[model samples]
Target: MSDVASQAGRVIDAGAIRAGTSNAPGKTAWRIAWGVALVVFVMLWLFGKPVAGWAFDVPRAWRIPVQRWISDAMKWLVDDASFGLFSFTDLTRFLATLVEVPYRLVLGLLSTGIMDGRGSSAQEILPPLSWLAVIGVVALMGYFAGGRRLAFIVGGCFVFLAVFGQWDSAMVTLASILIAVPIGVVGGLLLGLAAFRWRAVDIALRPLLDLMQTVPVFAYLVPILFLFGFGPTSAIVATIVYALPPMTRISLLALKGVPDEVHELGRMTGCSRRQMTWRILVPSAMPGLMIGVNQVIMLSLNMVIIASMIGAGGLGFDVLAALRRLDIGAGFEAGLAIVALAIALDRLSQAFAARRPEHVAAGAGEKNLLARHPYTVAGLALIVAGGLAGLVAAPLQSYPEALQISTGTLGSDLVSWININFFDQLEAVKNALLLNVLIPVKRFLTSLPWVGVTGLLALAGLRLGGWRLALLVSVLSCLIAFTGQWEKAMITVYLCGISVVIASLVGIPIGVLAAGRERLWKFVELVVDTLQTLPSFVYLMPAVMLFRVGDFTAMIAVVAYAVAPAIRYTAYGLRRVDPQLVEAGVVAGATPWQLLTKIRLKLALPEILLGVNQTVMLALSMLVITALVGTRDLGQEVYIALTKADTGRGLVAGLSVAFIAIIADRLISAGANRIRARLGLPEGEGGHR
Candidate 1:
């Protein structure tokens, strides 16, 4: 009897301990914090005007003079600052010249003939590669890298460029890519190597990389313009800056992911640190490093278009000119040329990244160069023969104007006809979306008291993460208010928020369907890949044509550009759900719908949230481009600053946008991590976690 009593006592104590653990003090504190935040928000909303004007917006007197301070600092750097041996201007000029040398050489080899002397006295000493030769070489590369199918696709794209009369412009764009990608890849590799080797370096670089990637490309141009002066060199420098982060990040990850056995083998072999890294680690990480190379190529292409604003010039310049003139037909053609270039390059690079070494039979290395490298020999022969042919045949040198096609007039007429026939329908749809959805959301967000919103977000951060995250969120949020950009920031939030919601609604359903159907997933994957390959600018043309310039048009563009990630992430998450869960549900008599809703979705919530987080980031990035069409948000502020050459204004606005992204990223990521923890899943799969 005494023994039984003691056992009961022990059981009660264990139950009490479990109860105490479940009802921890930290959870209670968070609940209290949230309750207080909610009450504060309600009070602010009810008595917003009566409480204080400062609650709604920061007063002009109270606003920080960050813009002025930044402007002054920039002026000092440009006008007075110097390294002991060289003035700032002198340093910039030297860097510019250094970038220019390779750029000029590549441009001459691809687009313009190598010239001697100045202006009217200049003579073409050697002709640029024939368009036909360039096409053949690229197709051969495609064949060698991937297969015949890839060869046809890439070859077709290049042929389209020549036949559409975009050869020279396309070549120029290609030249910029060729120059920028290598520099970015090499520089990023070195940085990534350093970070991987040193814990201190990695810790220091984390925030910088985050900032570099999150900051808008437009913001980069402002500083580069100020320091390097405006030209292709400056543009190339900006492109390199924009494209470097992904490579750096990927290289570090790849290096760290190298197998433990490989590391052990290198050490056991008594290899030096340099030899281990270069001969063993790097070779093993080649696949991932190649992925970094692919990213560098794609990002360089994307930035080169934006870089055109500062005089990079290419298909990008053509598109920008056409947009400025509202020549939709010309813009569409140039945009299409860019798409072709992007697709070809993307495919070629991806194929190269995925390629593996073939097995060599005995004595294979003894073969002649022609036998060992048939593709290389063939490419060289094509180049020499085509160049020689160009000297004799004009058609071989450059595509003839008579053979080139111009669909600009037809495209313009088609658009005009559509507007004439369907104006009422288009207007009704646009007005419906504007009246019922966009405007109301925009008003609600813009009308919120800044103090209340900031507090609520801080509370959310605290609940989701901890005090450190809460403090970070609050500081970044208040910086926007302090800089007197509260309203513009709200406007940005409104546009981005609505776009993300809509994208999620549309994309999630499609993703769910695609996840269940293999054929549908494959088709969706292809479309998504193509859409992602196109530059952000391409999406705007179609939106502008349909809706014209307004918040509605901008919203449409943002949704289209941002939807890919939503679909991609949703499908990915759903597919990754464990099969055992689904089988168990089936065994328990759950229907397909029930299994998906109750088991699969429950397990996939964290991943879906991550998708939404990515969707938000992409939407924000696209919104900046939508500024070209009209939208009175932070993006417009950056655009205006760009036009005015106001370094301080651009940087400040850019930072405000960056802060918004950072806030969204952190809050959503923290929430996801919490969900993962509750589900007993591992963390660190997304965001800061």
Candidate 2:
């Protein structure tokens, strides 16, 4: 006995052993408390009692008075007599009047009333200048930023747009995008900077960013349309909401990423905090911030189509109308136009961000005219050429007609073929999947008593993290139940659940396969980038056509959208597994499968869990868009509320979805962290995990 005691003592110090065990009692008590609280909360909610007393009373007591004050402030701001408060409608009207001036000028020059006038009758209203003139402008902008290759690529985009017969709608789309993107970028920058500056502000603002990013774009349209009354302003507002989060996140990330050495240098150089932040930190962060701007532009252009659902006319409206009328050619034409715009904007931003300071030749400043600044001179020359071409083309009626190309009956014909050849088979498959798979799963989730699910979730949270995470998840779940949208929320959760499962099944293997080699991993990463960059709505049409407006379609779309992060983090985790450990396994004569499963895969599990977290997030993000297929969930509620302009209903439903996402996000994050800790993964070593 003495010998055994001595050996045990040598193995681990008594104090250290006791200290390690000390966490158990506290954790047990916390878990007990979490269980009791969740039980009471779920009881109150499921029994149809006033869960509101606990859930909303605190917020209402604080929020109502504050909201009233904001309303009053807004009223005063708009109604100030000296500021033409009585004439508030003029704000919109004045802007409209300004737009009309340009509208008239362009119309007069082209002799086409279609520039501003609305008519159902089709008319060929091609631009006055040749396509070459527009190409020149694109090439000039590209040349200014980079070199000849970029110039040709950029110019080729415009040439493609024109040749495809998308010139007018494309320009209109461009005009709307140019106005919307700058607003989103500036707003996001300010908000992000403010969040970084103040802890309380950041705390308050974080939820808004979360909501803005996760809630379906459909949910936002109602509030914006109500405020702006559905036009360019409404479209711009929705675009801003959709695009701002990335910019804010990027801005915050970039600022936080500024090096300590750079900060020290700034301090030693006698710079004030403000000066240092502006001149040193901001400039250093510019590359990332520029990337954010690029993202904002891309997202804004993407939103243009969704925004059109609220009457914000552009290429989006054209596409939607064409789709509704089953005009496949027209739809594809508009889609191609949107794609062109996306590519052009993406390339332009990338090139501009990459531009560096260049050396000037001796006495080059004296060489003016076309020699000093080639791009500027070239741009001027193109604009002049365009004007002259317009004048020359005005007399020939056949010129404009020849320039205007159409898909004619081609798109409709193709769609008809698809509907006849593929639609029935797709429909049958979709029905089988929905009835056999999705229905059973959704029914099972709905069959669970709210208390049981709540208890399990809280328990899972407690096991994964400590009491804090458990409480957060319990409260979040409880809120969704108390909001009187529990069933709908469950349906949404069910859809998300299936999506995550599907994502994991597909993503993990791909990740493992890709992680085997550096080049293969890079190629997979490129695929992920493409998936994320492509618009969610672009996925929607094919899904709708295949699955035909049901839960099945929504689930499929969610899977496609959410799988990117899973593949990304999984590959990252597996690749990051210790090489030495794998070598050791190899030396032990472990086969490739055994080595991977036992060593690398085990280490990669935590990262794989992180991928699950992202899958949840992406699934939630897809909810609003997926609701277009008419699923009976919180997303549907949001969409309906938007159509009717019901702010309270929309906010409530939107928040419910957001709360659920937050709960899943927190729980999964906690669980992943715990797993990572156990796996001995180094701190801050994993990306998403």
Candidate 3:
């Protein structure tokens, strides 16, 4: 009581509260166990045949007849004449028809023909001028949007694409993105506002939106392809689904963050709710909304390659084509072009968001000069100059044949050579992994009766979260079983599990090492940025080359991509640990390992848990993507649905994957929240609000 009580009574000393380098009694044993577990996981994962087989073999087949019966019933209802007025099919068809007219008009212009009903001119409708004219105009727009710096960057990116002989494809991708982004922004804004204003709508939408956010992109593509058919129409629909979440979240946040006094003032000015929302709320939320737009554009761009699968012709299609034929260089170039586009859009949107609204007097010189905004004037001049120069300068409009850079047949040859050279080595590992790890795991999961699996999950919930989370997990899991895709869903969960475990194994240590020095953190950040920016498809070529096609290749690709976030979060968590803790460890004659394990890591658990959560989400997202290498899971189901235009199957399968994600999300989040509460971290007040 004398010394301890005195210390406690004095000013609540921060240093005393700080952690130090005192190892827990079983720390060594725990570390050794972790090390052994990791080795066994990797070895059994990479080399053993039965282990892989267990991961994939199905002990129980889902009775999909119920789903098939439902599909048949739905099909019959749509075709039955007596149900016309109330038929959801009829309503969907009507909506499709409404959108078709504009879609056709745009498509017709891009095509080599005109719609006869419009009675347009027979002459080939040029885009008002040569390619040079378009470039000049866009460069001007870029300059106006930012400055000469942005103009140069934007113009340069476009010119590079053109000179690389990918001019047409680049424009196609750009056009779709330009259209999709606005639609996403508008749709997200409306939905978000509705959710914010109406408690009932909020309650109803929260789960649906959660479903949408977690659902695999490939799953939704089937419905979109069926409803809209292939081409830009399908692309736009999928893009909207993909990009809408961020906008919804950001808009809600901005609206909720608006000052109470400001909102009251608007009401006092006799503004109605609509006016308050449109004029006051939206304006106040501009910066946040612009950020949402930025996210929308980025996400839309990310989807472009996938959208290509359904014939939304663009750089995405080219990448896919190159991949199909194993043309690495062409794929790499196209991937780089995508990266360039992303960077340009991100910078431009950030500028827009950061720009402040001006407050000016009527007589101000700045106000007068606004008409001649420097960037605008400069842009206009460039447009004129470029167009005029193009009229005489042939090179601006067309690439010289002699100078055309070509990856040529070498790309294909490289792929073929690698496949031929390493097939034996690859096959052995693949066979072993498939038989040992993938198949056996799949069998074990499928072997569990639905009731048994649900019971275990509930027990886990009780341990890690609480009764509420246990109940939520149990209900969601049962939903998947009832949907008749339980086995496939389990496979997806297994793959995600494998990928996350591997990623954490690799990512956490790197993060720990990186966190030890400021310079290392900076370097790790740069690497993470590059990985994030590069298209996932780009990595596929290398993965196939090194590991060949199968679960291993898929694992490698996803692990590489998913590891970035883990490293980032770990470094961040470790760096954020109290400095006094480290000093205390040093003063107490503790070793580095003791300091990290007993002091820093214990304190950093909350943040690291969040990182693990993100890692799981990212890994699950790769499930469909990795299916390109061939795997039997919900992702494979979505892939099949896309090819067959099976909307019912795709949507259901996608929903199953989403349910799995939601269960994981709820469990991890509840656990994290509980831990944070105990550790005195700030609590999240659910959703954006």
Candidate 4:
């Protein structure tokens, strides 16, 4: 009887242990949080009509008058504000003039001849650099930067620009980028340095940096347009604003990452604070800082198209014109020019960033400059020879129109053929997607009570992170609601959400396949890299050509533009999975499918989630550009405000979009972190296995 009782007690103890292990405290908490949220959501859906009326949408009476207040403040600034001795307009005009000086100089050097007078009386003093000379110099720089391969790529891109009749516009765009990039880099570096030196400044700058980056590019133009008035100056200012944040953030990080040993070395040398920062810290951090420069360059080029709307005329203006007229051929040609320029500059900058200086023996610096830098001398010689030859040959001075090739006719013919033969099929596919997948999802999302959605998202934040994340999520969500942008915000979410889902669906499988095959991954890597280099505006052209302007067209563009990150992140994550774990599974006699499903996929889940988070960010950014193709969401609001020069309205709408992006970014990131923790991974090991 005693033995039987002891056996029963042991069985009960075993059951208790099993229960504790299966339902750990954290797991139980998660279950309770989710269960409560589900019940609340159901109850809200069923019997909360009275609350839903107010909660579904914030009434105008309850909405904040933020727009009016901002508008009034802006008006006051423009009309009456002064900086002691100078009025606001005075300062703005002076700043504009400062920007215009370098811009005009670069524009003259590249695209237009220097002018001696104003208007019709203006006389050309010197012709712009010969197209051949420009190309040769750029090619030489490429050769010096990377080698023959990079030289060919850079030279080929420029030659294409000239041969394809996009030389003038491309140069104009290039000029803007050249000017804006330097300013952005300098200003960002200074700001970063300041922030790094002062902890309080770093803290203060964090949220501002977040807003500067997350806010749609279009939102930038409104205030600049209002303040500086419209022209290339305003556009340059906007580009600077758009490109500055990344450089600043990168610089700060780079400075922080400099080794303590470097600091100690500087101090041992009796270096002053300034000398230590410039000579020791900055040089030690140069590689990371160059990454910031690369970002600034890329971002400056990306802004070219959007900045054109405010009068930074170049390839951007050409593309915008073609887009507006629905001229597919012209748009494609101009878009390709932008791509060519982007790829060339991207490669050149990346090469320079990765380049290391060769060490010189003692007194090697005494060599003549011409002998020491053969590439530079050769580049200069080519430019001089080309310039002198241009004095005799008109063709050398400017590319001949007759020699230029255009694909406009070919593009038109292709479009015509497709429309004539396959229009019905295309329409069928588009309609089926809209009717079956898009419209229903949009309607359901739009129908959800704003309060309920906010609560659910907040609850998600709570489960994934903690109360702090939950509070942040709810506040940002409420900001949209109280701003009277709840409906439009929901529409934006619907579009972005659907686009993300589609991108993930398409990108993940390809990424998975690519991960296991080296050749396939190389091909996928090349494709994604090329796709990423194209500006956001370029994606719209193909989408519009295939599916005219509407929500469908917008979704297609957003998906194409946003899908690259998903593929990249997934492949990267899968590649980072522990090979030993795979070996162990194989040793256990697991089949290929079982190894992938139960081992690789499980371990890579956190990384895949991060990829999705990146996908969400890219989707939101592209969705703003989709506004050009007639989607009515927050992007449209910003667009309308831009047209009207309504600073407050544009800012309000743009901030709402930023809020949405932030909430999504934070929540998703937290979820990924949670998964990492559960997997027993160390924090901040996102880049490692």
Candidate 5:
């Protein structure tokens, strides 16, 4: 812990110290700040509660009136806004029809085997493949993309969803996702290309991306609800909004990653700019673009629950219903389906992204068209088989009744048994942890004056990057404070703060162990993969059961949701340390602990810092979700605003979360930069963009 703190302190200002002499202003400011921190620490140790709640908090009078004004303004806009022949609502309905064109068409094909559902009549012009055929097709694609192992995984996923009585819901969810992903990809791609072609466009898009990524999803739900109204249209729209940024940003990154030499080569060939971008740049960036696609899919999956809240029906709706009814077992079953679906989609997309041309050629010569296009051939064969089978057997026309299963009952019973048998012990553990750790921390942070809180942030920024960052942080801190949301924002910060602390402590040691052993590393990789892909809502189910609801529950959810990166980065950093250094340590007769602490960890500290930065961002992103657990924080504020459909309140609260995340991101990034600089590593690319 002491080592972690020292490393963090050094990282933030390592460059600052080097950038100036001992007597420089930056050095002087850092010294003064250190002295102040020490004094405050002593004061807290002595005075405790008296020192905790010193109040320079933003006043309520300043906040509530502005909220009312903004709310009234939004209401007026909604009421007064009109077009030549239609109102905003009418326009939304027209757009909704546009969105639903492909959605309903996909639905008809998947559910009823209709090809052209776009017109008045549905025609079974296409082969209506049954569940067996769909599973076979997916398995065949997986086999082609990865291998037999992937085939089994893909086939098993379809079987699991069908057998668990989610075949219809699964299809619905998949169709919606298919509809949203393409729109998000295309929209994001165009935006990214625009940004790539123009520096001004990139600069304009940067902060918007940050805002979209950082804002709690719930915060935007209300306005979106009003605009798009309810059902799949709104849900798909919401998903597109949330998922677009990463794709766009990655597009920019992929384009930027294309080497300058490649650009020069294109120029030497006399390729026009448009030709170069379309033929050379886009194709060259396929690998990165695929990665961006992977992220879009993940983001789309994450939005399933949020989408469900607004009337998009599918597995997510079932989970949300269960959660509302406090049916942990039911929620768990549906949530598990989500997890399975996510893994399947993630694996297939990842396999495709990572697939090399040689991997296909490895099967047979390129002249063997069957080998080159195995998946396509297999898919066509399945469609033929499925159509024939469906004609022969009615049961084959849809998911077979004999194969379906329902685990909802079993889950409920299991949860009931556990609650009866282990309730006391669970309660005891929760109580002890809350009393000893989480409560005190929350109290102290919520009680702290806004001035002091901002001051500390400014101090850290100042130490890291002198006056520029200090001013930026000061302004960010004031943004929340000036909004009259200081206390709630601080509470949100405290929750994230403590959750990150717990995550780091738990994750770092495990990472060290994993890094030292390959078997452990592989096992940890599986765990990390599962955890990262697990929908953020799944953690809430267990948290609710354990802590019931409130700050403690919210804290636990945040910790679970955010811990993967800490472990991943620690192991990654340690493994990346120069192998020669470890060999030298071995020759010096250094113990395993000595080798780790003195060599690997020391060298890997920068990456570990980056992991912490990610943890904070992830934790902050959970604020609105955590609010559902009933915590009195910015998340709760957003949640309340969401339920009431108060756009102004939700927007303000959302901004508060974004600003906090931005501040933390800025400071940690600056520190990581300092660490990289001191280590004489070349600066990383794709940072500003």
Candidate 6:
């Protein structure tokens, strides 16, 4: 108890809390600050821009000359860095070779015959595992993890893969993920364990993880490409970087949340560090570790499309090819394969996370075979059935030629149908929104004098979180302006801002609807999980079909990717609202509407605000990818810089995006804190936020 209390004091800044009666004074101060900000904004709106005339933009002579330096530095590090004793280039090559061994091994098993040429070549690496054999194995494993229903769902996914002739592509993708998930999990656990053992390490890692999560994945892809020289190695390494953060975060949280009593008991028993961790700490943290693995799987799969760009051959490549050719049928088929893989893996991991260990003693087992080895019996039964099916007919043995189906034409046909029947209507709606809403918002944000905008943001930050936040937002805003990327940065911000509003407007209401109903929540979660696990690139396909190639299409893609977290966080917050307060409202003769408004939503505000914060972060992360669909934002600059291998330009644009995310994150976090303070809630009542 004493240890926990001490730790809590250090974790939360008491001076900043203000979660008490003094909140009245804090609220009054905030109101006055807002009033002043409003007046200043009005004055700027009337006369400032006319006088300045885009003078807020840093002159070319004054703009910082950092890009060239960055580019030169990166080139030296990648192509020439050495200590006279050890060459960085050689070391990276060695690592790539090490990664490629397992890559070949997994790819060989799933897509090629093993040792076809005794390691001389990778041609003919495809295996001959019949469809029935694979299906039986999956169904049996699914049954073991969840139950009959899950088995059916998983089995159906395979059937879809085979029927759609996506089996090869799907399995190749799964093979890489099979390798990446373990690497991420192990790496994350080690880092997390180190953080847990040392307080300084934890503090240092916190900001690193935050920045890493915000850095656009596209920003780092080119550097990784240079290091690993493209292929499965580069793709896998990039994925490791992308997926590792969540594991470390989840593991750290689990370590911190470990019961204090467990530690005390370990001490009393004179348990060694290794023993305690292996036998107690890890066992106790199984649920969190399992969740981390689950996330790793989903993230690895999500990287499929990005990985494909670098020659990590899989369904992602097929999807990209289809998209390039505007072959919706082909793209949709490959995308479905990805979706199937994600859902199956997510469900299996989820069920396994909830699995309970059997408690029976070795000598106390039941005599009946079924009771003694239910899972084993089921596995054996599946093998026997698969054998019989394989012998009965070739069609039943593998994805038979006769049974294979293609959606090659369906995509084009659907596109044609939409273009003919719905394109005109959607174009009208799209044009109206572009002309009246999106374009105006972009212009307004871009026209704001950078100097004035900086002041307003700093003022807001000061009102919310004092000097630290003021300095943070001010520095970030100035960096963008001084880099001469202010115009592009504003457009990025405009996209994120609009996306957040739309996401909140749609997500929060759906969340509210699902919060009170278990079945509905489950259904919502299923759809959300599917969307959340897809690569950001996948979203552009549908958006392009609906809105065509433009900034508006990119905005739609951003919203699609960012909205899932909003819905999830809102529902979670509403559900976590104090039941006792709800009961009190009911006892006070409150109606359902009154109960929700006065009790539930009132207390859920902080969580909703945090959700909005996450939505903004996600929107920012998608900017670079959305540029693929055509958008003149910072992402476009990053994309162009990367393609041209201009390290300085890419890194600058990337950092600008990161800066936006951080400012938005901190500001929203401050708003959440203020809300919590006003409501007199503890700084830590937020559950799983």
Put down candidate 4 lDDT per residue, 197-285, tens digits, no spaces: 99999999999998998899999899899999989999999999999999999999999999999999999999999999899989889
lDDT for model 4, please.
0.87
Give a tens-digit lDDT track for model 1, residues 1-689: 44433322322233432235656786688678778878878888778767587989899999999999988998999999999999988988998888899988889999998989769999989899999899999999999999999999999999999999999999999999998999999999999999999999999999888888888888888878888878899999999999999999999999999999999999999999999989999999999999999889888888867999999999999888877766777787888888899889989999998999788889989999998989889999999999999999999999999999988667667878888899999999999989999899888888888888998888788778989898999999899999999999999999999999999998888888999899999999998876776677877876787789999999999999889888888888889876765665666677777777766776677888988998998898999889999999999999998998899999999999999999999999888887776555689563431
- Between candidates 3 and 6, the lDDT winner: 6
Where is the poorest 10-residue window by lDDT in model 2? 10-19
Error of 1 at 69 (Å): 2.1
The C-alpha stretches of model 3 lying farther than 4 A from their native spots are 1-66, 69-122, 128-156, 363-381, 399-440, 584-589, 684-689
Count clashing residue pairs per candidate: 1, 1, 25, 0, 1, 7
User: What is the lDDT ranking, best to worst?
Assistant: 4, 1, 6, 5, 3, 2
lDDT of 3 by residue, 180-288 (tens): 7888899899988998798898788778878878898998787677656676777777888899988887888778888898899998999998999999998988888
TM-score winner between candidates 2 and 3: 3
User: Each candidate's TM vs. the true structure?
Assistant: 0.92, 0.79, 0.82, 0.94, 0.87, 0.87
Q: Which stretches of candidate 4 lie over 4 Å from their true place?
A: 1-23, 359-361, 364-366, 687-689
lDDT of 6 at 41: 74
Which wins on TM-score, candidate 1 or candidate 2? 1
Per-candidate local distance difference test: 0.87, 0.73, 0.73, 0.87, 0.81, 0.82
Give the clashing pairs for model 6.
Answer: 111-125, 111-126, 112-125, 112-126, 113-125, 113-126, 329-411
Question: The CA-based lDDT of model 6 is what?
Answer: 0.82
In lDDT terms, how accurate is model 5? Answer: 0.81
What range of 10 consecutive residues in model 4 has the weakest lDDT sum? 8-17
